[model samples]
Target: MLKMTKPREDETRTSAKKAGVITLTGQLAKALVQLAGLIAFSHLLTPRDVGLIGMVAVFLLLGELIRDFGLSQAAIQTAELSHGQASNLFWTNALVGLVMSASLFVAAPAVADLYNEPALSSIAPWIAVTFTINALQMQFQVRLARDFRFLTLTLTDVFSQLAGLVLGLIAALLGAAYWALVVQLLVASATLLVLRAGTARWVPGAPRREAGMSALYMFGLHSGLAQLVQYVASNADSFTIGIRWGAAPLGIYNRAFQIFSAPANQLLAPLTNVALPILSRQRHEGRDFYPLLLKAQIAISAALTFVFAVVGSLSEPLVRLALGSAWRESAPLLSILSIGGAAQALSFMAYWAFLASGNARQLFLHSLVTKPILAVAIVLGSVWGLTGVAWGFSLGLVVSWFISLGWLAKCDGMPARVFLSAGLYVLQSGLVTGAVLWLLNSKFGDHAPSVVILSIGFLAGGAIYATLLCLRKSNRTVFRSVLSPVAARVKPLLQRN
Candidate 1:
């Protein structure tokens, strides 16, 4: 038997902090690249062109999620994985990827028919090719994550994003229209696969049946179902809008969502990658992880709330700034969607809890109940057009957040009082920030330059949030802990200067 040395508390903390910083830096770089691409693409492509891609994106995203089949999560969460088991999983994932790719190719015409867009028939199949590549790389990526090789993971992600953005821009310049977006997807997936294979030291051995394989498969089955339901609930609005309102409105709506969700996707998502593996290890060792989890939840909630507040306040200016005046209609949608963004940012922690605790069944059950409610909300909201759908989507998110809290309390033994109190504190902070930003926006009116208004609102809201954080002892400790490393690095630089 191989003996593994358990890292001391300080060592573990230091390693985690380093990994967090690397992941955050990478995500920030990727977000900047994507933001730059969005600005250029918005100008290069018409709303119809963007919308056409959005219409096909639902199918493509579903195919990718289905291809994953939760096996990646299974690999990450499992404490002890043998070479044989890993090899078996690799084969299973590749097979599923091949099937999904072929399935999407065959179903492309039907998807096009549903959207009443013949162009989608060609677009969907090309996008579908990414699945096999993604599948082949799944275990490699998971192993990097499992071993906390975040630097390698971050490098791969950043380079892939940059490469894809460049390719997509070139394709757009060449008048590929919607195909530009397809090129971006294909290039990004291919780049990631190539990089992961090159970087990961481990290669899968020949597949062989191993003991305890059934448990992994079972866990993956539930996890995959939960993922499928969650995706459907989240994307149903886009699906419905594309079918009813066509590509233009869907394009605008999709852009608004992407913009508003930048912080969650870029920042919080990466942190979750760091959090899950650590938490899983802690759980297996019977260590109490609630303190770390709680602090993280509070920090993420506070930060994202502040971000969304600024976004809500400057929605019009931001849309104009980011996408140009041609996409001014996305402004209101962005504002409405910001509400959901805040809700999601906070509630997303519950997912980490569910996965790290090895409670895939509980996660699936929660999704089974909540996803239908969300789907219904989207369907009903569709009757009133894009704005109504945005409203409904936000409402659904808020509801899901509360429901998830209840589940965490009951199923995971999280203290309801403690969790709810922390949530309310963050909610209060967000409201105060949002209100201050709103007042500033109202006072300035639309006459002010966007840059000036945005600068004022951001500074003012940030000051208010910082002041509020200092007023609470717990918040102060959390803030200080987060900032201490940065302060330490800056102090030496300042002294040298």
Candidate 2:
């Protein structure tokens, strides 16, 4: 284990920021591959085909939540860990994963019956295998992250995703139908497992009593349950929509939701990977970690939220271009879901803040309160149907963010200021960008080429946001700092060229 002192704040900041850049680039590459799959699958497979898989996915997501037992986050948050404890956690994860995979396999029939989709019987078992595949490598990836080996992590992520996409596309083209989706997921997990094993080659010793086993277990339990509830909060809408509306609409909802969430997951989620070990160090060292947290929030909100804003505003054309005209129904859903996605981007920091402090209890309690609020919101909104579900999820996420700030008030520096300094201005910029694109979209989206609509949307939205940033000295300074990583990378490449 490594220790840090207050004097090394700048060094620590530089390392964290560099890791973030590497991780985000990797996420960008993976996101592009996922985008390719989304487009290819939408054309090759029907809404019902993907929808059936979506139903099985709802259950598999839970098994995934169970397998890791939150040990990955626990490892990052802890300052000291012996090889014995690492081996213990690894075996525990392997056991949990094996059991979860078997349980899901055995219960596939019940899941199929519940969804009234017979294909789920076949789909659930293979997907279930992913639990063990992913679990076996959880700590390998954690070791890389703890050591800030982000470049390696990035390579692993991109290569695995690319491999999965190519294999899945072949399966789809060969008439695998929904099984192609299953194969895609399995191959991805397996590829990631192989790569991680190769990269972080640490052999686990037999499980034994460790000095801090009790504390580790207690921490992991709360963290794990908190993760489960967090999954429920995030996926409740998918589960509800699939159960209530059936497969066809659920499939569309799933894709639309993925697009809406792309910014948060692809853009901001990687920050958590970079921030955890660093933030844990800061918390351990009695230093304020809120500045880094806030900087990440602003960078995400300004850039990613703006992208989603344009997507929401010009969704019809984007959908038509990406998923084809048959999937127009997803347009409104993506538009509505963007609101929640933007808020969710900022909420990532607060969630990880609790983890960094090793306060799994606070994290768990916060999830218990806010996640239910989200689930209930989605359930109540589902009463009105698919559009209602979208509204419910979006508004619920916004409400959850506000509550999360309040819940974390006594723990860290002012989180509300993170929102105020970061999100509020971006919110204003998103609204403006949305309005401009909506007008352009309203006039020509139906008759114009989608490529044109998207081209103009990207250009105009980005220009508008950038110009607006330049209007204020304070905002310009903030954005310049937030975007330093991209500048650093691009500047070197341009000079070489």
Candidate 3:
């Protein structure tokens, strides 16, 4: 097994530990900024105004898909990336980004016409310009992630999110209306530029492109395709909802989904980001890699599921209190979207196994097949409006897990039953917590006291679930494995609690 053969010295262990600490710190900081942005944006703008931006956002998201030709993944996943290859990718990305941005600029009128929104004609062009600036910094960001140089990443995010928060608030204060869109994109692009300048150790020059370009492109092609498919599937609901329900309803659904997904995208992503590069480094050598990955998945998934289930069940009161009565409509959508997010959380970790095995095509195929099925579900669900769309979106995630798990089992040489059994504990925990919270909420409805009472009950559910897991033979074994290393430090915290 590719274990840490040479024990990490104090300094090295301290450094590696800092990565996780700083990553969490960064995630928390970014989440706070985003939460602030959401509140500020919602207050300053109407649903119609947000919806108008949402329409432009759908196209911008598509632009982001195109922008992600997977240079970042390729750069990160490659075991032996070089200066020349990095330089070549930087230029290639910049060139494509320029072309895409220009096209988007020209196509602004058509996009506006598609939605019959006249104001979009001017707004679309401005938004497209941000893509050009973003392309310039994409490779640099990838380089940092590849190395798990998250201290640098944390700095970039802290500054970037701060910039966006400041600018977005200014735009709102100025009564910029759609100009808030410009503020967001511009700040993001500028932040990338600042981050690139600060973090990148090497800068690209005119390339004397070599064999590395071929290797990098091959890596990028598969990675990009997989990401493209994944992005499309992820955003399928947005596209479908926009088409069927128009901007206002789509805006409401989008906001609700955003709230449910914020923790996942904002918090859980760093875990995957750290996991991927770490797993890739261990890929060829670890006999224990598969088991380690599974264990990590279980722990992280259980934690996230516990948090979300509690929040989802009690989202009605939280939304009303936090966002006010106008957003009460979002409560149901948040609950449904949270279920989908739980499925997504599992698949995201399982897919890391594929990434670690150097199997981008397998990942690509997994999403390629799944995106269509998801897209169809979105279409079918649109007949019933936003609620149908939310349910359909959740259904797709559940279905995708089964399909991807089969492939994961085959490739990893892990027994499917063992893997399922491990996850079953998590599922059982989530279901029980969800059911208890739901019953409690339904009986009491959404009174203010119910929030505090159910919040404590939710915490109790997690404690009960963890105790149950510790009692189970398989989970006990896994927990023991995890506990052995940190038991000393963790014991005090447990005692104090």
Candidate 4:
């Protein structure tokens, strides 16, 4: 048995913060790249062109889900992993990626036929290549993450993504249409595989059978299935919209989704990356994890609340400015999706808990129970078209959030009251900001430029949120807890300047 040495609590705490800062900075850079792409693509490509890539994205996402087959998660969270086990897992990931890539290549024509769009036949094959590229990246990334080498992880993410975006932007300029999007995804994957593998340094000796390999495989199986179910649930709306109403509506919804949810996901990702490995180490060391867990939850809810507040309340101006007036139709969808985003955000930390605790089977069971609610809601929502679907997605997820909290309480003995109070406090503050933005928008929205409208929303809504937090002592504590670390980090950069 190759038992990786556990980190001490104090050292782990310090490293976790450094990891968080590094990863967050990286995600911020990546978000900018995405924002730039969103702006550039909005101008360069037609809505149908964007939506066509989105249509193939379902398969691309499926390829991603299958590539590592949950082994990455299993590997990261394990208390101990043998070198032989690791090598075998790497080979297993490579084989799965190869199989999925070939399968997707064969399925391309059928995918095009399913969409009744001949263009997809070509697009899907290139996207199939990303599956294998990304699969090779998995074990390498897991190794870096296990060692808390987040600086390398972050650099690889940002630089490779920048390269992809540059190439994609060039392709679009040269009239590649939807192919530009495919090129971006492919280049990013290949770049990540190269850079991450180069930095991870460790090499697999051989894929020899080991005693503990079966348990790890089982863990991967369960974790991968759980993630697949959740992915399908979250994306049910896109599939339904694309199939029933075709690409136009799907295009609009996709834009809204990217704007509202993509940034939030990027923000949440660093937290998980930093928190899970630390928490797993804590579990292996038999230390208390709730303190760290609560801090992470507080940070997540506070950040998400502020973001969703601005996006939801100022949906019109945000969509207009980012996507131009052609996409103003997405504003309502963005607003509705904001509610669901918050609901999902609340449950997200619970996910880290499940993973850190190494409860893959339990997590899988929980997902089975909760994830279908969103899928069902999306289906029922299509009865009313896009608007109905948005509401269904939101309301269903809210239901799932409530159920998820209850489940976590049962499983982890989580302090539900504390979590709920913090979430509620954040939610109310968001509501206040929303109200402030609503009055601001109603007064000058029609006459004002989008930039002007957003500027006013930021100042007015930010002041209102700050005031609400200061009104109560408990809320003030929450504010300090979430912001002090951020302030501490920023102060040093200012000093250096």
Candidate 5:
């Protein structure tokens, strides 16, 4: 038994590293694909088309969240999961997904009526089918996640997105109107089918309803609820804008928000993917996780803040060049919202802490508190129109960031001072970024050679922020701890500072 376990332990270590690398690589690839796809699709489709899909996406997101109900997360986090547990969860997910999809299909007209968009009456149901298609692969996908076989996982996302991009473009070329949305959904479904077959090792079986699984279920349920609240809060602005300002203004807001959120979302996604399983294992072993968690938070938070500050300041020029003048309304919204974007990225570490510690109940409570605050902000801001809504939405997130910091300390045992130290680095970075942008804006003018100014400001801000971080004893120590694995590669860069 000891001899057998030795090799197994070695294999686990090797697999963990591979999964980490795969997670990062996959994020980079997917971001590139998504960026390219967005650019191409934007040229082909109007903002109305994007807004129509965005409206439908609200239901789709809600359905997907409901279908999940936290089972896959439970499966991945639980160390003692059995084959029977996997099978039971799979069927449960499938049943839930089917029901959700059918309900959405039937309710599409009502949703359209509520949103006051006649076009959405048909478009909504077509998007509903994705739930069923998603159901088909949920179990298999969960199993792949359980072992962190992320190479296969990355391949699946890359190929599936590629398929959707191709299909959507073709439909656009053929002048399929909103039916192009259907083609995108169908292509995505096909990709899921292919991915499910490729990655899943387990097959469906008669589920054995086990007694010990309740703990996992309870944890997952709370996690899911927290996730749901977070989702609704994040998208509240989009919903309000779509309903009140209509598709055109909503389109601008959505596009701007999407672009602003993309970097932080992409950076944290792969880390969170790897963090859950790894941290779950560590928790099970009764090891100290706070130090490791803090290190990751500091590194990610600093980089995200620095990058987003630059992006937010240069958003006008960036939007004009990339998205055309039709999207000029999005510039102010983008800048304000990027503040929230940066904070959201920083606070996300707490989410992982909550999950890792099996404290989703506390997390749910936090979201419960945060969501109402956000809702109020959005409601009040919408009075002034879409930009007002954006301001309110982003403001709420900034407030929530501080609240989350307190909760992270109280619930997850992360030290408060660590965040304080990182917060200083972030502030310095933001200030430097603002100064650089101001200088560039003054020298070159808003539209005159904006891209060049944008590029230089970004580089200068990044360099100064990094230099400040290295010079700071507290921040530097944390940074070194987080980047130690690649210290050799980064050593020259560090020295260059």
Candidate 6:
């Protein structure tokens, strides 16, 4: 077994706290940039144009996933990795990226043919370039995570997103249409690659057939398979919609899903980035990791529940305000999708647990079994159009959440009851808040402008949720635990000044 140096408990806790703060700030900034870009792009591009890009997104994302081949996860989960092994993995990733890029270029015509969109033929190849850029930076990103260099990671992420948003916006102004979205992705990937290479200390040497490399490769292979299944499962809705319902409706559905999932992707995504490395370290050190995981799930679930509740309650006004009246049809889709956002967010942490515990095979098996069910659900839901699809997708998410928790319990020896108990408070709080907001909206939502009504709903829902959380001792303890670190750092700075 490979052994590694472990940080002191206090230091680890402090680092984790700092990482959380930095990552959350970065994600918030990125979200703002993305939201602004989306608002601008929504006005600049037609629904068909946005939907065209969304159609290609599934393929590009799949290619990106294949490019990584789960090697990044392998690097992070492994306790010890020789420079030779790292170099080998780097080269392997680059090779996969190159091949996938070429494959995407070659497959572009087929994709366009499938969707009967001639423009996609041009769009697919441009998006393929991102795979190469992303592939080259994979190991560097993994190393940054391993070292907990979140500040650097944050800077890279924020700057790249800002750059991409600006470029995309400029392109849209110049009438690039769907190509503007393509430019945004390519620019982001290129910027991230350059920033990562400049900031990361490790440099790849020549690949060597080292002794430990085989295990890493095997781990990555399983992880890659699991990620592939998960990606397909997740994006199947878009794929089916794009093919069956066409671009305009797909665009509306995609945007609604994006709006519905913002809380999970915006908040929990950064948390997961911070959590996995720490959890992996904790597991390696034989530390008790369940409490940390529980706390994280509770906090994320509670926040997601609250946010999604508000969004779901005000789906119509939110959609109209965010995407304009042209996309008003997305309102019901947003509401339906938001129903499972909390469950999906909570289940995301299970991914960390699986990876940290070095259970990629189990992860693969779970995805293998569950993702097909999700795909089927999405297909069945597609029968009802976008709204039906949204409901179906949400149903799948709810089912997947329970299945994921059960798998985590079995694999990690975490009790199912504990997982359920941890999530119960957030679920209840969200339900109550949603009910209150729904009632408020029904009573007086039409009396005011959408902006005013949404503002009132948010404030009222927030107060109710806060009150409910404060009533729970456990929830208060979790809140204080998260806040205490920030307070500690801020107080020192104030005193020094």
C-alpha lDDT of candidate 4 relative to the true structure:
0.83
RMSD of each: 2.0, 2.7, 3.5, 2.3, 3.6, 2.4
Against the true structure, what is each candidate's TM-score? 0.96, 0.94, 0.90, 0.95, 0.91, 0.95
lDDT of 2 at 233: 81
lDDT per residue as tens, model 3, 1-497: 11222213342222333555567778888888888888777777777677778888877877766776877667776677667777777888888888878988999899887877788899888888877778888877766666556777777877787887798788889998768857886886788687766776757768674666776687678878987887787777887776666778877887798788888888666666566666676664554577667777776677678767777777776676566667678889998888877777787776777767777778788888887888788778878888888888889988888788898777666555666777767877787777887777777764547457556666776776677667777667766765575777888999999
Candidate 1 lDDT by residue in tens digits, 60-89: 788888888788888878888777888889
Ranking the candidates on TM-score from highest down gives: 1, 6, 4, 2, 5, 3
In candidate 2, what are the lDDT values of residues 395-460, reduced to their tens digit? 988888788787787655555755565676777778888889899999988787899989988898
Candidate achieving higher lDDT, 4 or 6: 6
Alpha-carbon runs more than 4 Å astray in model 2: 1-14, 413-415, 472-474, 483-497
Q: Which candidate tops TM-score?
A: 1
Clashing pairs in 3: none
Query: lDDT tens string, model 6, 1-497?
Result: 22333433342223777778778888898889888987888888888998999999999889989999789889888888778888888999999999999999999999999999999999999999888899999898877777677788888988999999999889999998888998899899899999989988889989777888888988899899999998988998999998887999898987888787766777776666578778878887889788898888877788788888999888888877878999889888888888878788878878788888888999999999888888899889888888778888888888887888889888878766787877877878888998888888788777778898899999989999989877888889999999887798899899999
Model 2 steric clash pairs: none
Model 6 residue 126 lDDT score: 92
What candidate 6 gets wrong by more than 4 Å, as runs, is 1-14, 488-497
lDDT of 2 at 463: 92
